[model samples]
Target: MSYVLAGDVGGTKTVLCLYQVADDNSVGGSMEEIYKAVYPSAGHERFSDLITAFLAEVTQRPERACFGIAGPIQDQCCTATNLPWVIDARQLAEEFGFADVYLLNDLEATAHGMLHLSADEFVELNPQAMPQAGHAAVIAAGTGLGQAIMAWDGQRHIVMPTEGGHCDFGPNTRQEDALLLFLRERFGGHVSGERILAGDGFGNLYDFLRTSGFAAPNPAIEAEMANEDRNAVISHHGLAGDDPLCTEAMRLFVRIYGSEAGNLALKCLPRGGIYIGGGIGPKIRAALESGVFMQGFLDKGRMARAIEHVPVRLSLNPEAPLLGAAHMALLRSQG
Candidate 1:
């Protein structure tokens, strides 16, 4: 069987997959896979070591490879956004002795894989409408907020990456303004959407709420999160309905997340739809479906009518980026 190696390289962990491409132009199946391998991207300083390890572990040798990198791709090389690792495609090609190699923005890869997702793979937060074939947007909140747009270029979908999450956060109300002030004092200067929307951002927001007197602390959730990482503990407490502070933080998070998504929809004109991807969205499925997200999304003043028609879906598949990398490798091979 013909196999292609695909990887989703993240800040904390890397996922690698060996996939078979089918005749119908879809990834047939994954023969081998690795999930959540801990690699110290700093100090180690090379993607080659990780690649070598993956190659040694897999049973089959792939003919081609594609990677979804966590940072900008310029001239076939990249420096990871949060890590100190530098990835050189030419060096990787030399090391792996592969004829084909492709690098893409991580969010772009996720957008490409969205084309193949079935209804069962996603939880529809807003069932009020469905997607049309036109423009679409994918926004993810993980270690960082990643954003991308997909437009139908007459025949097929073309994914475009954006640094939009880095754009300045616009306050919607007095409460948000106060939150911004609190964050500015802590972080200094401008605050981006990523500052309040990602994994670390959850804690930041929670801290802001606590310090700003927006919510009172619930000792149980606070203690659990204080011992562990804040996001997971906060989410657990919020979902369990055990803590009022956790609940409020979650509500605010969903609102901000939805507002940003709506802003993205407006900018991209995603008639095809808006897809919510990344680690956070999937875990808070219940909160997103509880009208908080949709309310924020449709709360736009005059343009609300336009956004109301757009369908929104939460990507349930965690392997989307890997699958997309394989799909890109297949496309490149065919060309």
Candidate 2:
């Protein structure tokens, strides 16, 4: 039996999985999982090296492979956004001896995976949401922000990857106006939405609050920053309301996140809905559920009503990108 390989490549970590395809092309046949592994992305010098190491561990070589990468894809090649590696689909196929290789933007993969998920896997944030048939949007904030659109024809969804997260940051309030100036100066130029909406945004916001006298810095939390992931620590304390500064940081983070989501909705007018996926969304579920998120979402003047009924869903599954890559591989292998 031939094997199919799938991977979810991210800034922090990479997960690879192998599945054994059914020998017969029968209607009831299915692929079975055979192997899976996770690796720290920073530990490997090149993506090719990581692939070589993974292939060494498995006995069977895959005939086809697909990877969901955190970057823009061009001509089936990608220069990873947060990693220092260049990935080319054709080169990997030749080097790894695979019959075919496929690459997708991380959010595009997540959008494909969303189609396969069950209703229970999603938490609806819009009380008045109306699920309908139309185009849809997907936005994720992890190490970086990602955005995609699922253009639904009468038959199926066509995932369109975009670098919308890099768009200019729009301030909705007086405080956010200050935030724009602060980030602009810190970044030494044009500040993108990701500056205040991504994982590291927690630390940025916390620093702003502390320096702005929003609240006195917590000595204990500050000390932990050096030992742990500073962003994660800030988010943890912020979500738990353990420190005033951290709490405000989370509030501001959630606010900006929702505003950006709204911005995506305006661009695509996704009537099917907007699915929020990423490593950070599930962790801060509580903060997202607070009314602050929705308030920020609807804060748009004159255009708020256009997307009020569009469903805003938070996907709880973190392995969606991996699953999507696997399924895409299986489909391509069959064809």
Candidate 3:
């Protein structure tokens, strides 16, 4: 029995998984026995710190390793987007005593994991259609917005990482333009989808609504939001229909999310489909299914027909990136 190690490194947490590869070189089973281990990325500036902790928790050393990171990977070195840590693959390979080590953008991992997911694992947002066999897009929102695309090249899906999320936010209407202006003022120009679609974007949207005198639940909730990061709190309230302001904020977020999804689809010409992955999509499924997202997605005027034909689905699995890393590692080991 051969085992491989995989890691999903994020801004807030890192997940490690061990997998058992079968005779056919496919993952037979996996045990996510380890979780939520404290990784002070700021203090421990090396990938070895986290790898050491992960090794300490597991009994056996993995033959190979791969990591899905939050930042661009170039020349075998990766710098995390939300953290100060820099990861060098050569250094990690030497320290871990592995024959091979692979690093990929987090969204790339998400795209790879799509091949491993069963239909039951996904929730279809647009059921009236099916994905065409061409290209597929994956966009996720967690600590930041991440986008990637996979091209169906006749035989297999080729995963490609993108900086589409960093592109300028193009507002459609007056209200959206106002939101863009607000974000620009706060961010000092170059408002990207990341500005309005990430974790921080939720709070920014809520704050905008509150300031615009939208109806809120109570002064106490507002105070709680002001005192702390309020996106999750506000999102929960909005999802539960507790606060009008939160609900409106969420609606706007969904609209922007759908529009961005549309933009990505257009750029990629993703006939295969659009898969929405990330921490935020699963949490806000209700709002996304409430027609706001779909409407915005299909509201591309004359091009609405193109958007309508594309199927949209949400990835419900949080361990997808880890699985993707393991798959990448497995492929490399076999090769």
Candidate 4:
């Protein structure tokens, strides 16, 4: 059996997969989930080192490899936005003795993965609209915000990467207007959408609420946060409806998230749909369904109805990037 290696290289974790694509040119056949593993991205100093460890686990060298990385791909190389690693497809191929290697923006990989996913893999957020015929968009908020679009040419999905997450954040309410100023002063210049929509952004919002006197912190939460993951702690308290400050932070976060999601829809006019992927979406699904996200999304005045027709859904498959990378490896192998 010919093996295809795929890697989903993200800010927090890196997942590597080895898939057995049949020699008969069948890619997505059943019983093809070979081996997969996850490693902390930050804990490793070099991506090559991580690959080396993973390669040792395999019985033999893979014929082809592809990596979906969390940054822009240029000249066969990528410097991950949230990590200090620089990945070069050529270097990887040379070092690993592979005939070819491919690199893609993580969201681009996600879009590819979306094509292979079954209907059961997704959780619908807006079931009112049908999956319209046109372009489709994917927006994920994990360590960073990643955006991509898929062109449906009446046949297959052609995925494209974008740096839209770095755009200026437009606030929808007075409290958010104050949030922009607060973030601007601290971030020291422009506050991008990723600044307030990502994992660290949750902590930033919680801190802002505490400092702005809008909500006071609990001693227990402060103590727990001293050791536990701050974002997780805040999200836990917020979603449980226990802490007022935490709930308010979640509200603001949902608001900003929806606004950005809507902005992406407006720009791309993704009539096909909008898929919300990433670590954060599934974690805060309750908060998202609390009407804040859709409210901020539909608050776009005259353009509201158009985006409303854009189906919103969540990608529950965490291995989507890996699956996408494997698909890319299959596609590259065909050529």
Candidate 5:
């Protein structure tokens, strides 16, 4: 029996899946699952430890494996952005006796996964505009902001990885200018767009508003923020409209998200479409649909009309990266 392993490696958690493909190796053949599990990345000191544990749970070995990791990938290796771990495809192959292995930047894998998604997998943020055939762009905010470009080569989609998220955060208003200054003081250096647009960005914006004396922090929300994931807590209260401060923060967050998404649209001129992936997009679909996101998106000044025509979509499938890694593993096994 031949099997392949696929994984989605993140800062907070790691997921591993083992799949057994049919003997014919047809893409449509039954790809039975052998095993699947999730592990807390912080619980293990090394990725090797986590991988070994996954293998221990299964009796059989996989012919090949691929990992979608959150970081820049080079030469089949990647050093995780938020986690202190270095993953090398060569090391994994040598140690596990796998026929082959691949390491892909998480966003690249997510972009690859886009090709296999159905219409139901996407939530239309702008259905008014029809999708025209051209280039496409993907922007995601999670542990960090990730960007990718997709081009149709007259056949399949080719994904090009980029670190555009690390680009400087351009504040469109005086408030954002102040927020940038605040983040500068907090980080003591260059503040990238990710500083205000990723998972930690929620807390950063909230803290800036409070510290800048623009808003008073609610004691109840403050307490909850301390006890739980600050960003999640803020997002919950923001969406609920239960706390004015949280709600304002949420508004600002979506606006920035929208503005950045617009920036992507302008950069690539993606008439094919723009995909908003990552964990945050699907959660705040309500706010996204409320026109606030579009307000910020259309604030593109002269290019506003051009961007307005670009179709924007939210990827509802959080496991797209994992699925893409699995597909890559299948290709590696066949080769």
Candidate 6:
């Protein structure tokens, strides 16, 4: 028997899992999940410390390990985008006494995992979707916005991670033009799409609407924001239509989210598909299905028909990154 360690490391949280594999250790080998846990990313000062704690609770020592991290990976090293830790694959392997270790960008891992998921795990948003063989794009908005491209090489997909989320924000409507100005002033200049599409975007959008006199600020929501997760509160009220300010914010968020997804589709022309993954999408499922998102997506001036039939899917599985890491480790181990 052999063990594999896999992790999905994000800015806000980290999830680690241990999988027991059959003796064969082949790509077709059977595997069973033995343990899994989630931890606050900020609780550990070093990535090594967190791994050490995880290992202490388990009796088996993994032969190989892989991590899907939220940052750019260069030369097997990563400086986590939202966390204070710098992770090196070789260093982790040496310190942990593992035979091998691999690091992949979080979106890359998600893209890889998408191939292994069952059909039911996805919700196809494009009614006119046409599934075919080609490249695909992934866009996820979590603590930050993540983007990746899955290039199909006739046999398999080669996942390419990107920092495209930090690209310049383009406004398509008059309201978005005002939003750009507002975010520019607030961020001191040059606001990225991530500023309006990520988790914190709920609060940013709500504040923008309130200051714009869209509606009177709800004192109850304000009080809740002071104590609880500001974004959560806003999204909750927004989804429920309990407050005009939050509802409008939610609408704006969905619009921008759809627009950005369209932009990604246009850029890559992911004829295979474009997938939506992140913590925020499922929670706001109603808003996403509310036609506003689709309208924004199809708003592409002349190029609308080019990608109109391209499938857009939303991944319901939040553990995709971890699963991808595990499968990737398994494949690498076989080689």
Ranked by TM-score, the better of candidates 4 and 6 is 6
In candidate 3, list every pair of residues with a backbone clash. Answer: none
Q: Best by lDDT, which number?
A: 6
* Rank order (by TM-score, best first): 6, 4, 2, 3, 1, 5
What would the per-residue lDDT of candidate 2 be over residues 80-191, giving only the tens digit for each residue?
9778999999999999889999999899889887876779999999887999999998999988888999998987788898989999999999998988888888999999
Per-model TM-score versus the true fold: 0.92, 0.93, 0.93, 0.94, 0.92, 0.95
Answer with 4 or 6, whichever has the higher lDDT.
Answer: 6
**Residue ranges of candidate 3 with Cα displaced over 4 Å:** 26-42
Q: Best TM-score goes to which candidate?
A: 6
lDDT of 3 by residue, 1-335 (tens): 66678888877777777676665644433333333344545565666777887778867678888899989999878988878888888888888788888999999998988778888988888856676678898989878898998988897788999998999998998888888888888889889999889998878888777776766457877778878768888888779877788888888899999999998888877888899999899989889889889877877889887778888888899777877888898888777
Worst 10 residues of 6 by lDDT: 23-32
Candidate 5: give the clashing pairs: none
Residue pairs with clashing backbones, model 4? none
* Model 4 ranges with Cα > 4 A deviation: 24-31, 42-45, 82-84
**Steric clash count of candidate 5:** 0
lDDT of each: 0.82, 0.89, 0.82, 0.86, 0.87, 0.90
Per model, how many backbone clashes are there? Answer: 0, 0, 0, 0, 0, 0
> Model 4 over residues 148-261: C-alpha lDDT tens digits?
888778876688899888999998778888888999999999999999888888899998899899867899999999999999999899899899899899998988888898
Off by over 4 Å in 1: 23-43
Kindly list the per-residue Cα lDDT of model 6 for residues 266-327, writing each as its tens digit.
98889999989888888888898888887788889999998898898989999889988998
| Candidate 5 structure, TM-score to reference | 0.92
